[model samples]
Target: MNGLCLVTGANGHLGNTLVRALLGQGHRVRAGVRDIGNHAPFAGLDCELVYAELLDSSALDKALEGVQVLFQVAAVFKHWARNPEAEIVEPNLVGTRRVLEAASRAGVQRVVYVSSVAAVGHDGTALDETHWNTESENAYYKSKILSEQAAWQCAEALGLNMVSVLPSAMVGPNAGSLTDTMGFLQTVRQRQMPFDPGFRFNFVDVRDVADGMIRAAEKGRAGQRYILANVRSSPLSDLIAAANTHTPGYRQPVSAPRWLLLGVAWLQERWARCVGKPAQLLLSQVRLFHNVAQEYDITKAKNELGFNPRSPEVALQQAFAYLYRQAHQPYEDLPQAAVQTVSSSRA
Candidate 1:
């Protein structure tokens, strides 16, 4: 299936990883970015950069011309959800609908929509693809739920091939925009422990998630959903311990009072909205951390798509390696033994 594959949001963390992976597999990738001039790093790479905004259906259709698979990777993810229906609805819900419409019109073979587990629920017995977030929670969650539902409905009625992959927390080697997962990892590495609720989170490497998405393009079942996650959930305490291995000045195993965190989370949320900054916490975010025992099922992905999410340690190593690379540190100069370990783990 070496067809022209259009990957939207190509300048994003997961999007960049996916484009590189698809290129490695000899797929002609038409990378859809909001701007083409900023793709300096991707200059020599084997990809076709097309300027497109999901809001512009015409540009979307142009990108999908002769395309076989479309990867919808762009979405506005924030801590405190936005108010005013337009602010929340346009990009996520409306944009997704537009993308689906374009894909359907162009006769695209299938689409692999990158979704989040948080889109399903704030708390539950580890929700699967079958579960969805309640509409009453907030705009962000509600938008994601609605977007997926619309995608499914449109896909079924139009006979458009579609599959969705939900990843809990995407970490490991990243490029392009900073994400919630990397933001937390960076804060923890800097010893910024705020209102520490020792809630657990299942993490999947970005490379692994990227691999799964590309695999979906070739092997995914139409109208199906897949959950990609590692073998276990890492509690905040253990995650901190693991993060310490990669960070130089990070404190190992830190905790803050739950009550203090509530106040801090609220203040952070308000400031985030006022200053156009990514918030550190929100009410839904607090609830998400409060429920510490939830988990998920990855057996379906393992059995169906041959997905194998990398272990936490391996993921962390690659993540740090990427960060350090971004800082202009030489990967070749790293300790030879560490390099060997990283290479071995990936293989």
Candidate 2:
């Protein structure tokens, strides 16, 4: 905790935010990315930028040379791919092992692995950090489970100090790319969703998740997993209501029956396959929404890491404002009132 910190995937949404948080705390940071040229996220930031591809062993070794804490935040998070094994699973599972091995070789003191709430099993009841997601059929969710498990195994074998943080659906500003969660917000804003699928998600701010990761790095126990999420799950209708409060013009989509949604998702998947693009909606996603609840208990994180996140409404409002600005005009061109709302939410 006393030395330099290396953040892999520094160009990503959470990773870039983590870098900013570390710098704000006066920690020397090494921002790692696959392409040093795509560093718009770290623009004007006081951090060392280095080329650190997860699969590139030599690059990782060089990146970890003077680093004491490693934030392994890089991974493939796509829900649909041409080849799930090669595109999603291998990169996550194998890349995690490679990065941890490199960290061990470099003698890094501690590591913080960014896992997802998808790795935690979801039943009808509220879930906690003790649960494992062994029932998920989604490729992305399975990858998180396998990768986190593999990371723990590798860390144990190499005698590396490591902890994992599982974040729920993240929403916040300054996202380098349009993530799936943000994309859902965009769809709602554009009135693209024909019908509400009755999906529920545990929303948290990306900045809060980054803060939780830092706390984990500083004080988390070795081999421990922390769930960084809101205490309760919010239905899609609630998100729609929040979005309407910020940007009033669109109405929430009508709720549809489960069978109707399943049919529509099947057709969407078929069309996606024919067009050689990822489906906007997948059958697995539809089924998961109906079968599992997104409720979680964060008592462990609060007691152990002092992790207290803001309300989901605040995060949703900020996300809607950010997406609106991106769609209509430049960030500087955003209305002063809207900008102030976002800035105040963070404060």
Candidate 3:
């Protein structure tokens, strides 16, 4: 498997990590990004950087040519949009279809579509790889579910070998603005936990997820979805505690009931609508947060793809260290013992 591999969304958090992982495995990687001019991240790396947008068919075809494996990681992820049909659904679903079609035409041997756990519908405490999130009204979650379905449909229609890896809440170094995982962490670090969102969900290190994506491409079954999630779920309070260990002067997070949070979310959504901006608190987010009783099952991934993720504590520490450095703090000021603990948990 030392052939050329194309990773879409190459500048993204997961995609950036995947590009590095693939390079480490001695594979020739073509980093597919929307802007080839933005080459700072891939600097000094032995990989080709190419411009490829998900909505652009010509770019997709060009990127797929001579590629043995395709890692479809580009998606429009956001809680709210001015026009979700154009900004979110069209790009995710239609762009996914375009990539699959181009891959089939180019005779790519394997494709690892990077989906999310949001695609897996939750039935109380029964959410797993088998569940499909068909009931979600959230644009981001719907895009993931429909885009994945489209990928499968294209694979079946063209007889292509495609596998999907669904990752849960991802945390680690290099989390960009695409998701709120790090933003929530920063909020806690700033002692800004005005109210507890009452959310508990699984989390996995982005590096572990990148490794899992490669493993899925190598060994996952065609048309099957593997959950690249953590074995444990961390609540907001627990995450704050974990951060407090590394962050100095961190305040413990406060709590609020689910009903009050829901009402606040509703008001926030209304305010966002009035101001023509995405809401920090959306009803869909609140609903999803409320549906986290059981952790997502990863036994299938472990048994089949040899996926074993580190604990959330390691991810939290890594994130804290990265953020601390990003804040222009001196390296000597960082918690050395905590950093060593995080480095040891990278297996």
TM-score leaderboard ranking: 2, 3, 1
* lDDT ranking from best candidate downward: 2, 3, 1
Per-residue lDDT of candidate 2, residues 228-254 (tens digit): 999877777777887788667667778
Q: Least accurate stretch of 10 residues (summed lDDT) in model 3? A: 338-347
lDDT of 2: 0.84
Which pairs in model 2 have colliding backbones? none
lDDT of 1 by residue, 209-238 (tens): 999988777788887889887656776666
Worst ten in a row by lDDT for model 2: 338-347
- Misplaced by over 4 Å in model 3 are 123-126, 176-178, 329-347
C-alpha lDDT (0 to 100) for residue 203 of candidate 3: 72
lDDT for 201 in candidate 1 is 71
lDDT of 3 by residue, 1-347 (tens): 66889999987888988988998899989888876655555655677777777777777777777999999998876768868778888889999998888898889999999889889855446466988877557888888888888888889999999999999878776554436777777777777788767777677889999999999988999889999887667777677777777766655556777788789888988888799987877778777777364367889999999999888888777776676666663232322221001011111
